[model samples]
Target chain A: MKYAYYPGCSLESSAKEYDLSIRACCQYAGVDLIEVPDWICCGASSAHATSHLLSIALPAKTLVQTEKMGLHQIIAPCIACLTRLKVADMEMEEHGDLKKDVETVLESTYKGSVRVRNILDVFLNDVGLEKIEKTVTTPLTGLKVACYYGCLLTRPPHIAQFDDVENPHSMDDLMRAIGAETVDWSFKTDCCGVSMSLAETDVALELTNKVLEGARDAGADCVAVACPLCQSNLDLRQKAIGNKFGVFYDMPILYFSQLMGLAFGATTTDVGLEKVIVNPFPVLGAI
Target chain B: MRNKLEEAKNIMKVAVKEDTTAFAKEIQRKCGQDVLTCYQCRKCTMGCPMAFRMETKVNELMRAIQLGLRDEVLSADTMWWCVSCETCATRCPQGIEIVEVMDVLRETAIKEDYYIPVESIEAFHKVFLRSVEAYGRLYEMGFAMDLNLMLKDPLKDADLGPVMMAKGKLKLRPHKVKDLKSVKKLFENVRKLEESRV
Candidate 1:
């Protein structure tokens, strides 16, 4: 299957491993990811939080390019990017004035025909669990994973429209297909206090601490996430969380694609596993 | 019980004005979310992850907007702290998208030049958009450097720089899209539109 890929900003930087693993996993799954040329940032949380017009225009420009590429479906690995793009698409479709205004800003018409899919949707729906199961070269037996769906992936259900907003099972089912045990956790779809990691470190730490503590309490070997913000808050800020709370919990925060890459027989380096702050090598070795 | 009834009677004695509907009408026009549909249900506040950090809770913010408490809602730090998790929107019994309401409030605050209670987040938002304006995508090193320099906290998240660099994640150079001029034009158009509205 062929689809357009919008990696967004984080994938090129903070979530490089997600980029690597997603590419590798897609290759194994026999899916073609055609990168949208000259794609701009979706403006993410900052744009909508600041200017309404810019937020719609930024993603509208990219969607215009996606349509130019003749791709009907596009997979955004970052949940935040997916939400931004989907919001733009939804706005353009629902409001003719917005579509006209965005087109004027973009200097191109937004057909709103492109279907935006997160990595989880691409894997679960596009590639299908049965197809992924057959491709699993190394079954992740005995590995208990806490599938953290953070916000934006399935949230504001009407916009995302991906899975059960409260208790999403797409990630869980994807993990199960790779022979990994998905742990039942309460904060699976909770907020990871995004962007606060930069502006409000304490609040971000407190929120991340809760997610980590919840995963640990639920007996998860590590937390698997789809969003770069979620991974960064949970993994990069773990040191700060431990230092502040005077509690140490070295739970590896991994991209769901990395685990899928591992299951598909891709080596650690292939998936950029070394990049993770809290290493999952020990746990992987044990299994 | 007598005191509560007296307070209710006193509140009922005050006349509602056309100005009270101005804020609610503007919000509805901007985001298509009807604040009037919110029936004082605290479900949004209860589900909001940042409610504890907010000066005004989600439900209260909704009520304030419905009541056209422009100054109260605009100056509060609640809208700034919202991460737009959408839990509030998803769980609202009335199907009101509370996140959209927060987005509208933030836009109104910026447009009207309201005194932002949380300046750092506002600063980050400006710096982030500036980076995207320059480069089609976010330049992490440049964005963080600009943010720290603006916030006067140069050493903030300084420790993670080397760690990220070692992992080959932090790029010193930005990946500008091929059509940089078009992106700039888009920004210019947005600026013109925003100015026209003003």
Candidate 2:
């Protein structure tokens, strides 16, 4: 299978591991990822707030680009990008005025012909869990992971429509396919306080701590996520949270794709495992 | 306690003064959902895990926004209360992205120099930017202490002292992030861009 891939900004820098691991996984799965050309930032948490038209236009620009490639489904790995792009598609489809307004701003036409699917949505929905399960060569037995569905994925399920809003099974099903155990916890859909990380550390710390404690309490050895922002909050925020809350939790948070690569018998280097904020060595040692 | 009727009246007065209607209007323009749809359903409050300790009412926040009660809406502690769970955003009948609305309000508050648990939050943001600037990645331990100090809540350190002692995890000596100059340079560039944008 081939996809028009949108890795987003974080994938280029802080979360390069996510970019690498997903690429490795696609290669293993015989999936082709065509990088979107001349793509601009999706405005993430910024553009959407300032200019209404820019929010839709930014993603629509990419959609127009994808249309040029003749690809209908684009595989966006970042949760924020996936949310913004897919939500744009959703809003454009629902509000005709919005489409006209956005088109006027971009001086281009968008027919909403393309669809944005995050990695998890594409893998679990299009590729099939059975295909993933069949490829597990080194069964990641005994690795207990917390499945984290960052706020964007499931909320407004109609736009990000890949899983249940209250209880998502895509990541869990994917984790199981890779031979890992997923904890049954309610915080799976909890917020990582990503946007609030800067202005509201106290709140961000509390929320991040909740997910960590919830995962630990639920007997998860590590937390698994599909979003780089979620991984940043869960893994990178630990030290700051430790200082604010006075608790130390060196929890190893891994991208779901990394674990999948592990289960598929790929080495840590193949997936850029060394790049994560929280070291996965201890966990890898145990495994 | 202040009279509930008088308090509600006063709240309305302040809300109007803040032009919260404009704020809500801006959000509606962006999100395409009527901010007025939030009829104090409290589903957002019910779903908010951290609502137990917050000083503001999530339901009233919506009302403030709809009424264009700008001052009340911006100043109300509810702006700080969001954990960004998106639960309320998810549950809204109008499909409002409540979390995004909160973000917009926060940014607006900052732009207008209104009020925002800013001292604490700004400090934390600075710490994060420092880390990102230095390592091109977030370093938790250093950023955490810096943020705590910024909060001026010295007790944060005192509270952690015992826990750190118990776990043998506290490092008395802080480590400068590797390639500190490069990180400093990065932060300098980011600040320059941010300054230019502002």
Q: Write the per-residue lDDT of candidate 2 for residues A206-286, one digit (tens) a residue.
A: 778988888888988889988887887787678887787888788998999999988887889877787666778887786
lDDT of 1 by residue, A149-246 (tens): 99988888888888898899989999999999999989999889978888778888888899999999999999999988899889987888889998
Best by TM-score: 1
Q: For model 2, state the Cα shift of residue B80 in Å.
A: 6.3
Query: In terms of docking quality, how is candidate 2 classified?
Result: incorrect
Interface RMSD, all candidates in order, equals: 0.9, 9.3
Q: How many angstroms is residue B179 displaced in model 2 relative to the true structure, after the best TM-score fit?
A: 31
Report how closely model 1 matches the true complex, as a DockQ value.
Answer: 0.78
TM-score of each: 0.96, 0.75
Q: Which numbered prediction scores highest in DockQ against the true structure? A: 1
